[model samples]
Target: MPDRVYLDWNATTPLRPESRAAMTAAFDLVGNPSSVHAEGRQARRVIEEARESIARVLGAAPRNVVFTSGGTEANVLALSPGLRAPAGPVERLLVSAVEHASVLAGGQFDRKELSTIPVTPSGVVDLERLRAMLAGGPPALVSVMAANNETGALQPISQVAEQVRQAGGILHVDAIQAFGKIPFNVSELGVNLATVSAHKIGGPKGVGALMLGAGIEGPAALLRGGGQERGRRAGTENVSGIAGFGAAVKAAMAALDADLARVGSLRDRLEAGLRQTTGVVVFSSDAPRLPNTTLFAAPGMKAETAVIGFDLAGIAVSSGSACSSGKVQPSHVLEAMGASSALAQGAVRLSLGWSTGPEDVDRCLEAWRKLSLSLLKRSGETELERF
Candidate 1:
């Protein structure tokens, strides 16, 4: 593990030292954040400070930030049926076909009431199809991710918000991947609700927040008991984890511009090297994408074997394909982008992070060169055997 190059930032990031320090300090305190005693007040203060930090980042009021276990819980909390916007209560849920698994689950909505809006061959949501679906629905709750995890394609959120507004619907943005990487302001985008994970930005893995825009109300408690999170979510807060999240958010935003420039440069260098391999196909190359990510594939390669090849070479990359029941399948993201099954099955993702250095990128490129060469050799041998 000493010489390993980790290029899976899209899945998770290493916890920052700043976040670790904050959590360590919080552990010294001994009181439930929901209590009213002096010791409890101290813990409550820590949680509230963390809430304010996240709220400020998302352009939301402190009272509107609801802390949850992680991004998945936050997404589930936001998709509630009782949520109310200025227009009215949402009657159905509409999510893009390319959304994360949690969003595609449709939350509390029944399958009959949920709709999947298609994306274009380039991976952007089809606006016309969305319009047609919204035209007849009664203030549907639309969930869309700000950026795709696998392809790193940035969705047209501002435009999607406008259309939802015109349709008298509410928009929920899963901004987990984009929050720390780009300038993401839920208020500026006119989204009703937005969710982000702490771990994706170098914070603790078990915490996240759901930000409610002004005038949105009652996402209806997913858990009921305590008066925590303004009664929107219950149970005592993970004070230490929230403290870590606050520190991470502060540090990430403070260094946003510089980090982005460095990480982006590394990603560009990596992608350029990757394309030097023959038959490499970089997905969503023509669309706006996250600067830190590259999803690519070549003919005659499959994700499972390539991932193993990269790992054996002292590098860490990921297959875009999801493994189900011990079987590898094509990435839904690429399939939605009109990639053939063979190409989708071969997709591999290499993502950069704040700590990704030139050496890491070079290491990944070297590993890829070896893997690609082996793939071509195997393919050629198969052709010769066929003749």
Candidate 2:
């Protein structure tokens, strides 16, 4: 197979060297973190260090971080009605229309008890609508993502936090896509609950955590029969994966400024080139978004076909969020943003990473140029170089 440029960082990132080394070292441990034996103590230390790393970033105590299988699990666990502090049980749930699928499921809450908070046409949460919802309802659990996986639009979390708090509602932020890419701290953002994933920051998959505020009480466990994670999340830990997550967090945070500056510049250049193409549409261009993401579409283009064209051109992109990547459908996010059905169906996402370079951006633009030109010239059909 030929080497291809990777532009799907929002889906998952390549493992960092530091993370790889940490996982490799963790493999030597022969005991479970729950055990009290000598080997177990070492394993426990690894997990503790990982929790501490995440806690440090979230501005919370290590004891407040609960490990889970992945971002989805962590998000689901955050939806419990009792997952609040010094307050009564939550009677309602409010999730942004553009939230991840896991959050949209409403966890333990019934569908009838849940409501969707709309977003602006530019793909931002509608604060006025959210304010009205919070005011009209009982205590609610408000869920929102720090940055969107498809359009990378940054939510006005600080403002949302203030609104939720004023209405005596709890706030949960799915920070998986924004934690390492931008600044995110549970306390700093006035967030009571926040979840993050490992793979999104150059660590292994199947490992994530839910960071809780100090005032939080017993919200109940998603899994049972084990005493792990302070009895809040039951199950043996993914020792090696947690170690890798910690290492990746440290490395990513340490170099965040440099990565932001460089990757952001490449994205700007890539967008500039894409805009040069006639009839191109960039989603959420006017909104504050993650520095490394761009979702674009062309009139009459079919995203599934465009994705294949990019692949044939030795570049990897996606039609939308990774969860919906291969499916032929309109983007729910774009639809919520009030995009035309045609534009929503044809949108394609290209997300950059710390390892992306100027060469990769130029190559992607070349592929986009060829694909867009052909698709437009044919009035909908796609033609590209064959491998």
Candidate 3:
């Protein structure tokens, strides 16, 4: 087998060395964070330090950060109806049509009580539609992601926050994909709740956070028992995972600017290479997107087939969100963006990371080029074989 290039950072990033070291140190500590003994105090200190670090990175008060099992749980915790913010209690839910499967599942809300706000062809949330939905409903909890996990399309979160505020609705921004890749300030976004996952930012999986903005009360506890996380989430804390998350957050913030520039350039070069091939369409190309992501498709190409081809050519990519990659179906995100089923079925995503370099991009391009040629020949698309 040949060395493989990894271009699926959006699905989950490679763990940072800093995170690994932090986790390793945490693992050697003995004590439950809930205990009052010296060892317990040490464990608790580690958790508090991690909480403070993550809070500083997200521009939130340390007390407002509620650690969770992962992004899905963080999101679920934020969707509770009747949760109080400064405005009032939420009575319903409104989510962007292009939200992740976890968000689209209508967390904590019955199907009849949930409504969807549409997005434009560019994959941006439609403010007008959102306004109309809010107008017709009771105070709603509106959820929109900072960036699409599949296409990296950045939603109008700031604008959406304003709209939700005007409508007296609480806004929850799923920043799981955008947190370390882009500059994210929970206060600046004016969101009541923001979800972030550790693994998406180069920490280990199984740890995430729900950040509550100032003046916003934390949501009802999702898991009630031990009175952990200020009674917001109750469980024996995963000390090592939280330590890794803290380290990853610190490292990610420090290198954010450089990573953005480097990864964005790599993504551009890769996209330019793919565009040189005929019938390649870049999704959300005209919209504001995360610097490290490119979702593209070729006419007549099946995404699964293309993914397999890439793997065979010593490259790694994904057909869509890792959560839904195994399902043999068109992307719900693309469908919500008004993409034809056929085009959606063919879509593939390439997400870059801090470790991605020019050589990795070149290798991905070479593999894709060969795959395109082979597919074209089989389809007898002579006119499209120029690449």
Predictions in order: lDDT: 0.89, 0.89, 0.89
Candidate 1: clashing pairs of residues? none
Candidate 1 lDDT, tens digit per residue, 338-372?
Answer: 89998899999999998889989888887777778
Ten residues in sequence with the least summed lDDT for candidate 3:
320-329
Can you give the TM-score per candidate against the true fold?
0.97, 0.96, 0.97
Distance from true position, residue 269, model 1, in Å? 0.9
Give the distance in Å from residue 196's predicted Cα in candidate 2 to where it truly belongs. 0.2
RMSD of each: 2.5, 2.8, 1.6
What ranges in model 2 sit over 4 Å off?
Answer: 85-87, 321-327, 380-387
lDDT of 3 by residue, 108-149 (tens): 888888988899999999999988888855688999999999
Tens digits of per-residue lDDT for model 2 on 110-205?
999999999999899999999999886678899999999999999999999999988888899999999999988888889988999999999999
Model 1 residue 25 CA deviation in Å: 0.2
After best superposition, candidate 2 residue 112: deviation in angstroms?
A: 0.8
Worst 10 residues of 1 by lDDT: 378-387
